[model samples]
Target: MTTSHETSLPTCELGPGGPIVSRLALGTMTFGVETDESVARRQLDEFVEAGGTFVDTADVYGDGASEEIIGRWAAARGGVDDLIVATKGRFAPPAGSHGASRRSIHRSVDRSLRRLGLDAIDVYFVHGWDDFTPIEETLDALTSLVRAGKIHHIAWSNVTGWQLQRIITTATLGDFVPPVAVQPQYNLIDRGIELEVLPCCLEAGLGIAPWSPLGGGWLTGKYDRGQRPTGNTRLGDDPERGVEAYDVRNTERTWRILDEVMSIADEHSRSPGHVAIAWLLSRPGVASVLLGARTAEQLNDNLAAADLVLSDAELGRLTSVSATHLPPYPYGMIEDFCDVDVWKRLGTASSA
Candidate 1:
């Protein structure tokens, strides 16, 4: 169901028969962490007020406080009947059990439902590929949830090209429910998925909802070059927190990308983050971009990216500046032989 009030942002189907969601999704990863319940509620209200209908969270986020906060917000507002709510599991499993096991998934989904105050989840994602469990076991468990009306659709996150393909193939062969989408870390700074994960999604008709679209605040133009962060920002608190660690991404290439992004933002009179998001939306398979904001103010600023459209030339320039290098062995050789252009089409082909 769509939101009661029409949204200002454009919408699209997440995949074939998937939910029609806003181009920007509200990510509640910081709901119970940096953001208190009152601030989190304001964020939710403002997100819905701006016409956002998709909300993404995870069980491991704040040890399930994120989902609980969202649940309370929904309860206060009557319900989330008009929104498409998605959450992930497979990160915090049951005692002594590995993630993605049948028992683990079953328990995770039930607890998620209880926390989210929903009879059924709109989309359920497996947080990452679990090496200890067979893909078949995971699919079987998700299929059971779908059959029991616990989840409407299934998706996978943080999988490689081969892992994603294997999930789809196993679901098809085993006659289980196929995934409608795949979530990956995609942005101007990290087009690593363009090599394989993206091509597989495009071929398999799976929609892509990219997390960390701002490259964990690197693309926000807040951090300075050569100077270590020292404020209240994500990196300021912990520079080596995750994938966008300052030392890892403070290279010449990242600076170049930021320079281009800043230039484009000045051209459009928008924030560097908006330019970064608009560029991601222009990519082939992105159904929505997740905004991981800690406050309503930040979310409002990020949501404004929905209206910032870059021209083809501007898009090309950003793409050129941040292109990822394709590997040599099979990818480069195959493209050379079969007249099959892979990353080239994505504007991600660099010197191999």
Candidate 2:
């Protein structure tokens, strides 16, 4: 593994005809919580200077303080139109009605706009599928919002592949405002979405804005192998995190993944987290990677990945080492069915 690498960030369309945004996005989940407003502002400034244009936040984050900070910053920076502001709805908590109903969405969007001081949002996410609210009702509400100029585009997070396909199909058939993107947990360790969500997005023209590109700081190499996580780190501070993470991720599989990442990091002379982020940026269907940090230093360090375009060999090396195959059944059978003999037999039979 070699450690020397350099890459540059660039803008791409969020989806088909959607807004063009930076390859890397800033996630403000820690604002007003682990990171105070002052430090959060500094992090935002540094990120924008480093070519980041997409900023993501949820209404539930920091009890709306995150959006407030973003609003204040946008006010000073000459309004929200300059940046591609993305915010989420749903999960109202104490207010109840935690679904994408007409009432829920209207309330969420109004509150988000008030907090962010914006009239229209760039990408408005549903946060998650609201089973409590009929999908049709949710779609209708989103379409109304678009027509009313309240939201520029609609998006969804934490949804399944079938669910997303249905939503896109229904929207298109009804001429409603279609969802242009999806935000799912994606990283070296969490590839479950690759099975369905990634494929659906590829065909449906939905952009993939992957969250947890750092795997909750696991890919940062802060946790040592075979040792209890110690110190003030995210997982170190919470002992239960290790037990939960180690349940499926603590095996030769992860060790190999970490080892290869460290090797690549050494070759590039960057942090393992940087290498991880670079690998994710190269993945298909990834419009932007959501990078979050508790401090400006972490944000700067993660931003280094923007310029790293992994070599073919490096890409192959990481893919082979870190890839996890899905269990037997549909995925296994589908791959196994693709064979020279089977292809010839099927072709002959069809021709006959």
Candidate 1: residue pairs that collide: none
Report the Cα lDDT for residue 295, model 1. 80
The per-residue C-alpha lDDT of model 2 at residue 50 equals 88
- List model 1 lDDT by residue over 217-316, tens digit each: 9999999999989889999999998788999999999999999999999988899999999999999989989998988899999999988879999999
Stretch of 10 with least lDDT, candidate 2: 343-352
Q: Model 1's lDDT to the true fold? A: 0.92
Clashes of each: 0, 11
Write down the lDDT that model 2 would get.
Answer: 0.82
Worst 10 residues of 1 by lDDT: 1-10
> Can you give the lDDT of residue 307 in candidate 2?
77
Writing each residue's lDDT as its tens digit, candidate 2 over 1-352 gives 1112132457778877777788889999999888998999999989888877899999989989999999998888888565799999888733656568898898889899999999999899989887777788899998999899999999999999899998988888888889888999988877768667877888787888999898888789887778767677766666566323644466777788888999999999989998999989888778899999999999999998877778988977887776656445565565466532322211111110
- Candidate 1 clash total? 0
Best by TM-score: 1
lDDT for position 279 in model 1 = 98
Off by over 4 Å in 2: 1-8, 93-96, 241-248, 338-352
